[model samples]
Target: MLRLTVHRHFSTSSAFFANRAIVYHSNGNPRSVLSALTFPSLRSPPPNSLNIKYLLAPVNPADINVIEGVYPSKPSPTKLNSDNVFVAGNEGLAEVTGVGSGVSGFENGQWVVTGKQQCGTWRSGANVNVEDVIKVPKGASEVGAATITVNPATAYNMLSEFVDLKEGDWVIQNGANSAVGQAVIQIAASRGLKTINFIRNRENVDALKKQLEELGATHVTTYEELSQKSFRDKVKEWTGGKPLRLALNCVSGPETMSMARLLGSDAHLVSYGAMSKQPLSLPTSLFIFKNLKSVGYWQSRWYTERTKEEREKLMEVLVGLMREGKLKEPEHEIVTLGAGESDEEASNKVRDVMKNIMEGQYGKKVLLRLEGE
Candidate 1:
């Protein structure tokens, strides 16, 4: 549990007054472009707004691309002190410290997260529109609430939107050790759906396999294992010839195509990422003969297209899973930046972690704790 105080309003002399953020002036490599900014004390929110203080924010791989100006959705430049900059962070868990007039659903101390994309959530506190945020159950762990808006939502949505999956159904995917992949495995298992999970061969392959299997993966193997002439035969034996109706691809390339080939007729191949930085290739025969359907998924677009009530319902279901222990928090490490630190000091610390994240130095998910605790 997090130990922190939520103030309804800020006074200049109070420790809660200062707000710090990770901001970038231009698009470039993260270490070069990312910086920290501290602003004056926050005031009460205006009508239909809420004063939110973030508790935990995850450092996702997409965050790096957004900083480099390569992602499709980018945050608008925000004013921090005298400088206009893009404060970084797409997802976080926040506490409502102050509610504005005409805001009837929220009050001080309730936890919430934004339903809209590119919320600029890295800052310690801000005034956000009430309609843009959704309440998270207080029973949710801080990390689960912070990270839920993206990966788990993507996993759940992909499984549900693409296919009419039923119990004993089979699903196949590559990049099976990824955060989203792990969520897919767990969610599928809860529904009695089996998963054929594939990952790159790593040094600790055996240990990795055990970890995923413990999470309920039906079959876990390396991409190289797919090369075996009898691999399809083995998959058939596992599923008893049930059609693999869905394939989730994050690492696109020949590896993904190989996974897709195992899907039966009229199956859907839903791709959400391309970690390999390689183009996907599939013989026209797969489409003409097998009736394979390929489509791309973006969680940001899903949020934009859905109604606020729909989004709230999705959160309600996910929070229920968290409380029931059907969902688990991803492996993570939190990088904390003290509010009392100088801007240069805080910026340097954030940049160092960004550098490490870009280099794949952190094997687990990286989360940020910018203000208290």
Candidate 2:
């Protein structure tokens, strides 16, 4: 478990409050453009708003893509007092410090997550509308709640929505060591389905396989093993000749096509991420003869399109799994931000983390822990 040190102070006078945030003035490399800005004083929130003190925020690949100006959706630039800049980060967990007169369904000390992406989550605190955040189950760990909205949701939706999967059915996915991939393995296992996971051969390949198997993965292999014709016979032996009805592909290129070949007739191949930056190529015969269907999934778009009730129900199911110990939190490293740090110091620390993220230095997920209760 991750421990947080809290520093709490409050004043009746509005001018005595302070806040800090990681922001960018222009779209470019995160290391070059990102900076820290501090608000010397904050006024009380207006009616229908709540003062939120951020607890933990995660640095996701999509967040980096947004910083590089290549993502499909762009964050709107806004004034933080006088500077027109974009605040960094999208997903995080926060606590309600104060609520306005018109706000309901929330109170001081309750935890909530940003209801949508690009809400500028990497901050010490902010005043936001009640509808912009969703209350999370207090029983869930900070790391689990902080990282819930993106990867886990993606994995859950892909497993439940793409195909009518049932118990004893087998599903295959590449990039099986990724956060979403791991979630898929556990979630599928909980549903009584089997997973055939493929990952890149790493230095600690055996340890990695053991770790995933402990998480309920039916079978784990490497991309090299997946490419061999003989490996298909091994897959057959493992599944007892059961048809692989659904395939998840995050790493595109030839590796994805190879995985797709394992799917049975009329099966679905869902593409969510292209980490390899390679185009997907399918053999004409496989599409024509097997009637394989290629589809794409984007969780952000799904959140925007789905109804509020539907979203809440999905979250309820996920939270239930967490409470039941059916879902496990992924490995993570915490980056702490002290309350007394200067603007330059905060910027430097955040930039260092960003540089590491760009270089893939963090073997586990990176989450921010801001000071204050």
Candidate 3:
């Protein structure tokens, strides 16, 4: 049975219900600042709200950057036991368990993901405003819905927003093995667009290349290949001298500049992240003579700028792709918090995972399942 309560007070119930949130009082190192607390559980949804139980949440790099106070957007502090604190997740898949009196169109057992940005989804359960979440179709898989809003959306938008790519047209991008990068490969393949994917050379690079190619990548190479002038001729040969119209960059540095160099006149270079933590420098001749247009894309801003209906439409398209198997779930691992665990044990477990993620030990996406009892 689940123990039930609200805020700091406990409410009598025949069943036992509880809520545990991974929160940080101050922004700093994730391992040092992140801790677990047992917040009150919802007995019923507040007016115009829906009580939601989180099913799965992912520990994205942006979540860690938010805790480090480096990301552009910040999560609004959540009210818990009369005090406000920041929860540590940005994306999650949840199930509605209770609906407030004034709320309609939602009921128990509906699956959803937050429509709002930086929703602080790292909790077992909470009462969320109706407008904050978008419904996930029943056909969508748990992983697809849980991880949809950020990476896949970013990939879909970046591909269409910057350049008007057509079938057989070539696109170039760095970080070809990143989550968004992989999605780019698949989505482009679905649309008949070709991608020249680039990544850092690694010990298992051959296997990694094979994996990406299996997902529909036209070509997979490393930055080492991009550094060679000879490789530019090879890329030219692959595209039959057709200008690469779009360049997607997440890792910024000399490699990004090299990737941009492959673009032809009037091409657009869209950047979404700076994993290299270095400045993006390019030659003036490229921008002046080549007419290269440089731009940045943030998926959060895209949501804030659009209407609820528009957001749903995008989700509808993506979910349809998911149902059709055009877009596959990201390669990931789940980090679970058992219901029987103590707050200390849960906090330690999360911290250990964050530590590994920070150190680049874990290559695939990491999801979280925090069970509160």
Candidate 4:
């Protein structure tokens, strides 16, 4: 059996349950600072709350950055009775196991995703307000529902909100093999927009290229190919001399500049991530002559600033596309946390996964399955 180390004290209640969470007391390297803490689950939720049992939570790159204290947004330290630590996840899917007296529109066995940001989803169970969770359709795939909020939403917004792109127009983006990039390709294709994708040259480059092509990418090239002057002529040929109107940059630095070079006059380049950890450097001529507009996108901030109804409307559209089989979930690997595993074992597994993520070798998103569906 898993060795449960109770990290917090709890008051007596009608019924008690055990819960485990991955938390950190201070922000630093995840391997050093992260720990698994077991505590007493709430016996009964408040009148307006529901008892949520996490089903699957994704380990995103941003989650690691948050743990490292490098990300722009931060989760506040939460006091779990006696332990003051921050839980370490931002997105996940959960099941409503118990609903309070005043809670409506939710019942036991319904799947939901947190509606709020910095929700600390990396836990087995918690008491949350009804309004804090968004009900996902019953038929949604675990991977799709668990990951819908961040990468897919980012792609959807970037493709639709920024450029005023239309059918047959070309959109260019680097890190095309990434989850967001894949989503971009699929979403754009669904909207009749073509995509020019750029990825790093790797040992399995051909296979990766083929996979993306199957997902409706118009063109897939390498960063090295993007740097060459001849590539611009090739893009011109591909578009039949049409200007590429929108460019999405995730790998900043020189790659971003190259993406900008592919844009036509009055084009927009919206950057969402900097995976290369390098700053974006652009030539002034492109801006002065081409009138290219540069912008940054943060899906979390969008959720924070937008009205709840507006957010739900956008989610409804995305979910509808998903249900129609137009948008497919990115490939993912499920990391199941065993009930019999110790806290140390769980921590080790998470650390190893995070290391693989840093190395960029996993090739699939990692989802933490706290329990069987």
| Leading candidate by lDDT | 3
Write one digit per residue (lDDT tens) for candidate 2, span 49-70: 9899998999998988788888
Q: Candidate 3 on 131-155: residue-level lDDT in tens?
A: 9998887668898899999999999
**Model 3 bad stretches (over 4 Å):** 1-17
Between prediction 3 and prediction 4, the one with superior lDDT is: 3
**Clash-forming residue pairs, model 4:** none
User: What's the C-alpha lDDT at position 9 in model 3?
Assistant: 24
Per-residue lDDT tens digits for candidate 4, residues 1-373, read 1112344232223123267788877777887777766667567887999999998999998899888888877887776758777888999999998899987788899988887888799888888888778787655687888999999899999998887888999999998988899999999999999999999999989999999999989999999998888988999999999998899988899888878988889998899988898998899998899998889999998888887677777778778788889889878899886666666677777778777888887878899876421
lDDT (10s digit) by residue, model 1, range 61-162: 888888888888888777666666788889999999999999997879999998878878888888899988988876679999999999989989998998
CA error at residue 279 for candidate 1, angstroms: 0.9
Error of 1 at 71 (Å): 0.7
Positional deviation of residue 269's Cα in model 3 after best superposition, in angstroms = 0.1
Ranking by TM-score: 1, 3, 2, 4
Task: Report every candidate's CA lDDT.
Answer: 0.86, 0.84, 0.87, 0.83
Look at candidate 3 and tell me the lDDT of residue 302.
Answer: 92
Query: In model 4, where is the ten-residue run with the lowest total lDDT?
Result: 8-17
Residue 302 alpha-carbon offset, candidate 4, angstroms: 0.9
Pairs with steric clashes in candidate 2: none
lDDT of 3: 0.87
